[model samples]
Target: MMRRLYQSLMAASRAHAQWEIETTTNIIKNRKMLIILLLMALPLIIPAMVHAASLPEAIGGKAAYGPSYFSAKMFYGSIAIGVVAGLVTGCIGAGGGFLITPALMSLGVKGILSVGTDMFHIFAKAIMGTTLHKKMGNVNVGLAVAFLVGSGLGVTGGGIINRALYNYNPVMSDFTISMIYAVLLGFLGFFALSDYFKVRKSELSKNKIGLEKLTPMAERMQSVNLAPMIQFDEKIVPGGRKISGVFVAISGAITGLLAAILGVGGGFVTFPMFVYGLGISTYTTVGTDILQIIFTAGYGAIAQYALYGYIFYTLAMGCLLGSLLGVQIGAITTKVVSQSKIKAFYAIAILAGFINRIFALPEKLSQMGYISLTPSTGAILTNIGVWVFFGLVAIFAVWIIGTFIVNVPNLRAEYDEGSKAEYNAEYGEDNKAVVSTKRGAAQ
Candidate 1:
């Protein structure tokens, strides 16, 4: 009996050894195959990836780096960063492009490529955010369309102004372009960080009724018989307020100026105007702003790539993947957080970005060749820290994704408030008449 037991144990031990050996062998072989595939794929993908980001003739661009598609890593980065940044900003509604464009520029992306890629991501995000808002019944479809008309007109004008500026001072064009880029970077970053902090520090309101209880103006503009009567379903103190044609034109003009000057889709400025200047609620303003930005950016991006031959397709593709996923997640998350908290977070982020811009790290780094700054008019290519920053960008993006996931509950709460405000503005005492007019006017 003892001899048989010993024999059985020996047999079992042998079987276990064989299984381990096979597992080890397979792992090694698989790893080797993966390494070989990656090595082979790098050369094929590098050209395309660089082209996509619109990298200027270096690190393998189109003209110098040769025509090609972006790398697997680049696509991964854009999707990851784009999505995370979109979610992070989408929570507040202003951070979408703010984080994206700068990061792209830092990586030596130039001209229409950077802007176009950014827009692609912005559009993707907007779709997601808008959808989520719609689900929550926060999206004001009519008001959104009306506001879009104004912003659309403005974007076209901004492009014309850019051309005029270029023609006006060819000699100073290079320097002027550089200055503009710098200003844009600093301004956006500062605005983001400052806005984040401002909201964060403000007293948290238990009541979701923001702007409802504020000092009411005696309908000065409303009494002026503005161009056409707007409609709404919500009944508010003020019924169907009229939107002045002059106000609409002025709004469009400013919207266009910001789009041109800042190189954004123009939602940032448009949302505020819809809320204050036009007496729209925060919720409706955001929904409408998203709609308008979508159209404007869409047109601008197409004009850039098709007419002017701008845009790096590879990069845009990568960014698009990330943004689509991120925006959806962010919009969904908005429902979990409180309104005050969202505002607070936005203020803090804006303030941090603002401080960073004041340092002008990009320019200083460019001067030292630690980074590259690129544009259609001026280009700086390559450096070591720039490479490091790119990696940091990826890391920060991952961090944002993780952060949003954790904050989903809080985001959901805030979204609820925004949507609720949208509903109240559309159907409540003060806004019913407004809705009636808006629907008809928008049509």
Candidate 2:
């Protein structure tokens, strides 16, 4: 059962990752839209850059920092984080967004700032990527609308709780955030490791690809015929599946609250919930997850974090730029590596994050006077956690880049062959010579 759950989660992650790639590609292809987005962003980014160093030390009697809050080191540091995250997302097809908050927190960023900046980054990415999915006829309008309705309320409530905690005490806020990360990462990391080991053992004997079966929970949920059933994705699944709208809303609410508090896009959680909890088809879930991310992250960032003056524009932009490049590289590298290897790395990466957060929790608890510890002990433990987290992430990044470089020749050849085949299929053998001549002339 646990193994099945792990497989389901991985499936969802891959679906979400594909959606992310498509969305990003679409935005890049549309030059006019890209220009408009940049123009809109400049107003917020420029002023933040100018006044970051001298902005007020506090807002509404709470400690706050401006967009320029980061030094040159921090700016570059954020980019590095983004690149690794994108690589993880592109290569593994999930788990990239999971790294952002933990990475930022490890770098000495404030909890609220990390959450806010992460949300802003997600919102920006969503804005650019969502158009492609809509045009591709992937989204189910009714499903998306119902999910967003619940997500909106959940995010709003979560934002309020996060702010209230921060306003009451920074120590409490940090503690709360750290605790959340520790618990979540720990749970996920455990299952991922188990799945990895299980797969390794199975591969040694069976040496075959296995199909994933839906969980009993999903079967039961799909059977429920509560009123106002949402009929969706009939094009993909004959007759489609219907469940009580309340269940969908509840799932959305859970996803939204987690997104708001953790500063993740929540697709990681959303995917599994839609599939394993609600029994939605992977195709429908991916499309809907893409649609919901825009609304959930945007509202959470603007209303919850930005309005409270917790966002760091520079950090968000730095991450945005770095991730775009990283994702491209990671996606290309995926062609070279085996699926089992990829899954192993995913498990390791998640476990590394889990350990990082778990270690950080002690210091937060000590600070809040919930536990007692010597200052030196706390500092040493914190330092150890930071080093371990970055060390693992850095190793993973290096491995991916090295693998890509070594296989570049093969990848390029594959690309050329595929391109030629596609061109031949489109223009036919008779037109191939003429097309080649025209292409060279244009060049």
Candidate 3:
């Protein structure tokens, strides 16, 4: 039973990862999307760069790291975080975003700024990437709209709560954020580690299961008939399934609340809620997850946090730039590496994030006078957490990049073979027209 639960969680994680990968792919390959994102970002960037000093004081009086005062160190730091995150996202298909907030906090970024900046980065990415998912026929428009309505409400509430707490006391706000991360990441990390061990044990026993069976909870949710039923993914699931829109909204609300509090895109929450809690098809879940991120993150970033002067434009943009390249490289690397290897790394990455947040909690609490600790001890513990967290991430990044470099020839050959097969299937193996068209396009 425990194993089954772990399997379900792992499956949900995979669903989230795939959604992220598809979104990242769209951001990288779609020229129009790239242009649109750049255009949207320019107005915000220009002012931040040109009038950095005149900007409103950030929460807690920390100067906002606007683009104008671009620090090479901060830029590189953001890129490093992005590259690791992208590698984790592309390779494992989830858990990459989990690291960003904790990483930023460890780097001495204010808690509110980390949350706000991360949300903005996610909103930016979602805007560019969501169109592709819609085109691919994965999205259920009715379901997405309903979910966003609830998510919007949740974001507003969560944002208000965060700001209210920050206004009351910065230490309390930091403590609150750290505690949230500790609990969520701790739970997720524990389960992920368990799942990893289970997989290892199964491999040794020669009794591996590739996919998790749908849970009884999922089955029960699907059977529930309530008002305003949402019909989704008729083509994927025969005759499709209908569930209460209220249930979906509830799920979205939870996702949004967590996202606003944690500074994530909420795909991590949405994927599981739709697939397991609400019993939506993975196909529909992926589509809806992508669709809702834009709304949830956008509202949370702009209305909830940005208006309060919590966003760091430079960090967000730096992450965006680095992630684009990192995701591409990481996605390509997956073709060369094995899934078992990927799963192991995913577990490690999540646990590293959990450890980072959990260890930092004591320091935050100490500052809030919730606990007694010397300044030196708190600083030392925080430093240790930061180092261990980043070390694991750095090692994982190196492993992925090294593997990709070593297997480049094999990946290239495979790509060439696949392209040729696709070309032949579409235009025939000996079609001169295909060659001419390709040559013309290249020219």
Candidate 4:
């Protein structure tokens, strides 16, 4: 079950990577659109630049910072963090968004602020990057509509909870978020590590690429003939599968709540819910997941976080720019690396994030007087977690970059040959003749 979940998560991550590439390309191509976006952000950008100095409280270290504080280093730091997260998503094929909140909290950003900012980042990326018309064929109109209905409600509830907690006590807000991340990361991280070892053992025995069976839960869910049955998978399956719209809505609600609280945009959960929970085909799941991501992220960011002053525009933009570049590099790197190795790295990255969050918990607990530990000890634990997490992340980045650099020649050759093959296949003799004629003229 965990292995299947891992596969589902990987598939979703690839879709997200592709989406980012396409969206980034579109944003770059449309000059007017870019200008309009820049103009809209002018107010925030100017203020951030004008006050681009380190604060003792806000920035920490020699620099201090707060929720509203925006310094040059903070902006640049967000970009750096974005790049690392993108690398993880691209290279490992999932779990990139998981790092953002933990990373932000590690950097001393309030939990609410971090979650809100990440949500906005996802939203901004989605709106700018999404090309719905192309994906419309794979989308189930009924499923999407129903899911959004529930997602809206879920987002609203999640936002209210977060805001209420934040308003009640900022420390409580931080502690709540930390504990949530700690539990989640710990579960996923440990499971992933175990999966990695299992795969390694299987590979040694020359047994790999085994077929996946549907989970018992999925079979049971599809077996029940619930009302308002939504039909789907006409293109893939014989006739189709039907599950109650209620099930779909419930899944969406869970996804939306997570998105609002965690700022992951719900892509991670949506794929698994559609594929494993509801027995939907992967073909249909991908498109629907994309739609869910845009809506859930957008609504949560704007209604929940941005409206409440939790978002940081500079950080969002920085992360956006950095992730765009990092994702492309990481995606291409996959071509050069082995699958088993990639899986191992993914497990490591997740575990690192898990450690980072868990370690930071002590400090928050101590601050709130829930734990009887000295501030220095709490700080020490937090610092250790930070170093371990960032150190592992930095190592992964360097390895990828180093590998990419070393293999660029081979990659370039492959690209050139592939392009030529495609060109010949498309144009055939006419293009060849035209090229020959051009060459003769030049000669």
Candidate 5:
């Protein structure tokens, strides 16, 4: 089950990465869209510059890092964070967005701010990238409507909870977020590490991979004949299947709640839930997930976070900029790197985040008076975790960049050779028409 879950999550991550690439490329190409984004951002950035809050003023806590104002330092630092996250997603192909919130907290940004900022960044990307007409054929309108109905409710509830906690005590809010991250990261990290070893062993033994089996729960859910059923998978499956609308909505609620709180767009679990929980076909699930993610992230970020002033616009933009470059480079680098090394690095990166979150928890607890540890001791442990997490990520980034640099010549040669082969295959080796067309275009 853990292995299956890991595979589902990885699949979802790949989908999200593809969306990022497409949207970012379009944003670059469409100057009108780029101008609109910049225009929208200026309002947020200019106001923030004039009315930036100090740490204490923002959160009613001690100003540990001084005023929480925008600066070049913060901008560049956020860019670096985004770059590492994008590299992880592009190269390792899973669990990259998991780093953003934790990394932000380590940099002294409040947890709520981190979560909200990440959500906004995702929302912006989704809006720019959405090409709904192409995907409409695979999307079940009824099913999507039901899910969004539940998701909207869930987002409202989650937003209220986060705000209430912040109102009660900022430290308490940070503590809650930290604890949630620690538990989640720890669970996923262990499973990822186990998967790495399994893959390594399989490679050494030269074993063939097998298809995934469906769980009994999925079969049972699909068989349920409850009223108001949502029908789907008509194009692929013979006659398709029907499941209760209540079931689908409940799944959406759960996904939306998590997205609202964690700012992950809930993509991590949507694929698994649709396929394993509701027994939906992967073909239908992919299209639905994409549509749902756009709505979920946008609604959560705008109605919940942005309205509440939890978003950091400058940081979000910086992250977006950095991630675009990082993802392009990382995706290209994947051609040269070994699969085993990528898997190993993915495990290490997740564990590093888990360690960082878990270690930081003690300090938050101390601040909230839930523990009796000395401040200095807690700070030391927190710093250690922060350094460890960032150091591992930085090292990984350096290695990826270095590998790309070292193998540029070889990569270029392979690309040219592949292009030539493709052209030859298409036009034949002695096709003068194709040669003339290429020359004409160049001229």
Candidate 6:
């Protein structure tokens, strides 16, 4: 009798599922033609929508060094760059380091000072970003907390040492840290680009040849004996799996160092590390990364930007307003481009930043007389060309934003592919509550 009842329940569920499937099919059939048109139109329309957002003149004033407020152009300039930087940072799934740091450089912002300012804005933006991600139910609290505690201490220790050095000898502290940071970032960029190419070459080989391709780095990461493991509860590809604590610590430490020195949020490295290094499913990594950033970068933002007197109200506010909207559009773009494609594009964008900095070396050396800034009649022409190269970064940034808005409709079809639907469904409307529970459990 009990077995018959169980069978009857199964049959009823099958019928209901069949009915839903039939209805879904009909709806899809009717909308197929209309959907195609919408796809072609969205990419174009999104930019126009964004352009309509005009921030207050007071909020976005010029970026300058003074006791007085900034000019309007400077304000708008910073806002524009910050918004674009935030969008790209959020888009590539990396910390926005490669984008934001260079933006300050473009403005001829002084070192350490600019680093502090950029960090302040990054912290503000990260808070905004993670807040939105949480609302969508995409955050993983346990991993974020683990990352924060370990990352925080290392950053604090580094800061203490830096301050001590600067106080003892002004010349040594300022020059040494800045140069070290620049060299380190350049090195990391090369390492990151190298690995990206390796992964791509492997993929191309798999597609072109009969050879079985393997991702050895990924395999090695999985083999490590890191302890204090925790389950994400969300399945990435399929059946849920767990990840260890130690890898999380390592990724966090790297992020903190970058955050402190360069004043970047390190979201770029952190998100990829979580997804690839610690093996957290893609579903949980964004939220986890954001959560960690909120604290880690926030610390730097406060200590460096606000506490150090680099907080430009108008510039920060303009950045906040424009970036808020830009980030939304950027989030939307994730739908149109596939994850692999986005990562590739992002790697390209980062490569561009490295190229810009690398080529700027002549300008830097000449300013210090390490190289010649003096010009023959023709040398002026070469200097002009070098200045033009600097403008490539600015032009490239404009092109990215313009293209993002212009292509929205064309990529509309791809938008929903990476949506965090499971998270939204599971947590309902209370993601923070759900995350708190997870953190407590992990601890």
List, residue by residue over 1-443, the lDDT tens digit for candidate 6. Answer: 32222222222222222222222233334466336534643553444344444435444322222323333455566667666654554454343344555554444444454556666765654443333432237665666767887678656655555455545543344345445544544554454455456665453213322111213444476666667765564544455555666767777877776667666555645644554445555456545654665677688767645675645544555555455445555555655555555445554555555554444455444544555665353235434533543454355456556667788767664445435676677676698788889999999
lDDT of 2 by residue, 40-146 (tens): 55665555454344335564222343222454556667889989988998888877888888888777678888999999998988876666446347677777777
Candidate 3 local Cα displacement, residue 132, angstroms = 4.0
Global CA lDDT of candidate 3, please? Answer: 0.76
Compared with the true structure, model 4 gives a TM-score of: 0.87
Whole-model Cα lDDT of every candidate shown, in order: 0.49, 0.78, 0.76, 0.79, 0.79, 0.51
Pairs in steric clash, model 5: none
Query: What is residue 189's positional error in candidate 5, in angstroms?
Result: 1.5
**By the lDDT metric, which is better: model 2 or model 5?**
5
Candidate 3 TM-score versus the reference: 0.83
| Candidate 1: residue 429 Cα off by (Å) | 37
Q: What is the TM-score of each candidate against the true structure?
A: 0.57, 0.85, 0.83, 0.87, 0.87, 0.55
Off by over 4 Å in 5: 28-71, 131-133, 201-214, 423-443
Rank by lDDT, descending?
4, 5, 2, 3, 6, 1
Stretches of candidate 4 off by over 4 Å are 1-3, 25-66, 201-214, 223-225, 432-443
Q: Tell me the lDDT of candidate 1.
A: 0.49
lDDT of 5 by residue, 1-443 (tens): 77666666667676676666666667767889878877866765555445445444444343332224444456667889889988887787667788888888788787888888888888877787566566678789878988888888888778888888887887788788888888878877887778678767453213422212346777798788887798887876779778888888988898899888887878787878887778777667777888888888899889998997888888888777777777777888999998888878888888899999888888888888878999899999999999999999999999998999999999999999999899979878569877889999999
C-alpha positional error of residue 46 in candidate 1 after TM-score superposition, expressed in Å: 9.3
Q: Per-residue alpha-carbon lDDT of model 4 for 1-443, expressed as tens digits? A: 66666667656666776676666667767788678667865665567566554546634431222356445667767877888888877777677888888887777677888998898888887787678678889999989988999999999989999999888877778888888888777777777778778767463214422223456777899888888889988876778778889899999999899888887878777877877777787778778888888898889999888887889777888788777767777888999988788777877888898899888888878877887999899889989999999899888888987898999999999999999999988889997899999999999
Report the lDDT tens digits of candidate 1 across residue range 142-209.
55455556666676666665444435542232223334555644454444345445545553232133
Cα error, candidate 3, residue 136 (Å):
6.5
The worst-scoring run of ten residues by lDDT in candidate 4 lies at: 203-212
Q: Candidate 4: deviation at residue 28, Å? A: 4.9
Q: Where's the lowest-lDDT run of ten residues in candidate 2?
A: 204-213
* Residue 129 accuracy (lDDT) in model 3: 76
